[model samples]
Target: MKYIVTALICFIILVLISSCRNDFGFTSSTGSLKFSQDTIYLDTVFSTIGSSTRTFKVYNRSNDDIVIPRVALAQGTNSKYRISVDGVPGQVFENVELLAKDSMFVFVETTVDIMDFTGDTEFLYEDTIEFDSGANLQKVALVTLIKDAVFLFPERDAEGIEETILLGTEEDGVRISGFFLDDNELIFTNEKPYVIYGFAGVPPNKTLAINPGARIHFHSQSGIIVARDGTLKVNGALSTTEELENEVIFEGDRLEPLYDDVAGQWAAIWLTAGSINHEINYATIKNASVGIIMDSFNNASNGATLKINNSKVFNSSNTALLGTTASIEATNSIFHNSGQSAVVARLGGDYNFNNCTISNYWNGSFRQDPTLLISNAIPNTEFTADLTAANFTNCIIYGDRNLELALLDDGTSTFNFKFENSLLRFNDSSNSFDGIPAYDFSNINLYNQCILNVDPLFEEVAAFKLRIDNTGGANGIGDPASVTATDISGTTRSTSTVSGEGPDAGSFESSDLSGS
Candidate 1:
């Protein structure tokens, strides 16, 4: 009777184990501590100086209890920040404890003294925690910055920007590198699309605005760039001639894959600077190496505050929208896959992307980002930085099931990144052709309440035509409430807006001629 019972138990155990997938199966438990955040950001300048706070999480995966000996910044020799835990380092826990499979959180606060701030720029020091080898403890880079001056515009004030016209027209694809402006505004208006191989210069305080219907294209050999402390205000209108000129003429009896005669072609707009406030509204920005790149070095900080509302971004080899300013508040926008990223942020890029649909491979291929962001490196004379602070709300990110998704790289600047409530779909849908697995996200600082593994059920996205499918199942983008009956920008629609069991999903809508 005992032998029979043992045999039966073996059969039952085997049956239970067979029910699980073999590929993703793991038989052992971890014996290491896992950290939630590896890199922290402290990105304040002289113009905005104060105290800042950040937190890190530590998880013990070992079977035994783990003890943390010392929790402090391992700043080598020279230290610029006065870091404290619970108001003072002396008050920090000497023996932090965590049980198996349990977690503990540590808070770090930093203050910057404005009086001692002599340079316009400041460097974020890397802090480390030491622990015993056998014991498990995760490290969190809790970063904060107190800035009294704007590093992007250290020497220049709001009164020193002037427009410059270099030889009226230079060679095609020739770069107009490093132009400076102060106090006055700069304009780049041409009759037709002009290839700027280089850049149009502007200073920190100048407000630069581009008019509607202006077609600015980049050259293959050259790209346009903006330095730190410059402001760009681009205004485009639906009724503008430029809109009609660059309008996407959809082709279909039903719906077909989006067709771009030029694939991975040169991008149209590229801007990267430190602290400038960028406002790009109602424009069609597409086809380039990079859509817009706002670096955290030399010039700018409003990539956090880089507001891109009522715009369309499509087709590039690299990131479509990238920033690390203050925030990126974009409503009613369309972002198509360029290369590795549709949007990327690091070193203090705070973004608010609402009412948008980001899809890859709608033009017969999925969007993919080739670059990936890793960890921190010192920014003194060695490494270049791209730290960020980010926010994403009420948006649709559809991957054609492509292999590539997104990545955040090392920023020579500061670091803070956050992604809020949004919808993320299978961007890796086109498996055999150009699908790579979703890009590694360890480089991103913090992501909160974002939806993933979704099915938007686009009406044959390969054909580049989209309609809300009616008879088909509901296309879920993490949350439906993200876009109530209206949007953050207050755009409204009705169920009648949908046809053949089709309803629009993103923030923008094409005109309905059916009147159905």
Candidate 2:
């Protein structure tokens, strides 16, 4: 009796498996398919480069299972756009099935050459994705903007080896790949956009000047390196309108809007040891491993110099402004949204920030470092140097973390730092950080009339709008004499409707608070 019962159960399981596999009663779709969107805008794409993959859903709302007789691009195989229906990628598909009340996704991407079009430098590329043929057909539009750009990359030799220069070797004997920029590439103009691949090194004694309205895009792992004795000058003027017409912008080559806030898309602007006389104004640098690295080889006696004004650097995987034994003076600048600290002064440095905003609201991962970190000693190393001067005046140093400022001294070097009339975010909830000597908020010499642990009430964090409202603690409490006359947006800082009636701390003076 037991053997008979077990055989019967096996037969029932087989029948259930066969029933599940037999989905043969599918009816032809009668143009009743619904889509997630009627059109998909692929954003801007550089010539000869592919676009980011975009997906949309096709829903089968009917009760009966449906079979799409045909699904294809309107231009067929000749179309520059590519589509993948269900799990199959091709110009067309036949007999695609969708269960009742189910949905399937269609992925689309494109790579078009600008030369294929007419005389225009930028043109619109458009096509349609067809769901079915004839009277029962449904269509979805596809659009992309293609722009012509100047591409700079290393050439390959006869032996198949690409051109490369030496960026110092590692302790493990591995050398970093780089290439020097050509003489003709010294001056980047606004006539066209520039795209760089690999590390482009500036030759010694030469200067790379970028003019106003210039857009520089870097491919993955690519960046610019200023060699010893080299200089980089970004001469961008304030824009007359909101379009930032005169600002020099540096970002990754991915033109998709989805990558706008993504960090670490490329490398950094490396001002190597001995590089000097660097200046950046009215610039925007974003989405890099490290936005800018100012290194003087840890030689306190020979520090690199960078005078930056009216600039913004953010979305860095590492620190936005990384200074190692360098001298940096910044005015009306903004640094925010970094994976680690927004600003890091390590191994000692001479740094000064006036009317700047250093806020790190990094949600990409668990951030272990503070928004502003200053240390005279390298971690787990014997290297130590003197902190000549680290000063912050009329600035906002705040973040999502409890302690946005950290000062570490090995006690072997001069840790000279001061903050005046600024707003800081330091909340030692557990009294863990209050015990440290650097947390002595009552010290008049180091902390002078600085607001602590108050919400700045930013307009929007994700949109990079650091402007504060009337309720912001940074409003009208800044020392007018120490800050810039005009804010980052060219707004005058002296006038305010807020009660305190002074310049507002940070790179921005809120128009809502400052009645201007």
Residue 388 error, candidate 1, Å: 7.5
Off by over 4 Å in 2: 1-32, 59-68, 95-103, 169-174, 297-304, 429-438, 495-499, 513-516
For model 2 the TM-score comes to 0.88
RMSD of each: 26.1, 4.7
Q: Which stretches of candidate 1 lie over 4 Å from their true place?
A: 1-185, 188-197, 240-260, 264-268, 297-303, 324-326, 362-389, 402-421, 426-454, 459-491, 494-505, 509-516
Deviation of model 1 at 505, angstroms: 5.1
Compose the digit string of candidate 2's lDDT tens values, residues 182-295: 899999999889999988889999999999999999999999999888989999989988878999999999988789999999999999888888999999999999999999
Pairs with steric clashes in candidate 2: 165-178
lDDT of 1 by residue, 145-209 (tens): 33332121113237864323242236643333334434443664423233333344555556666
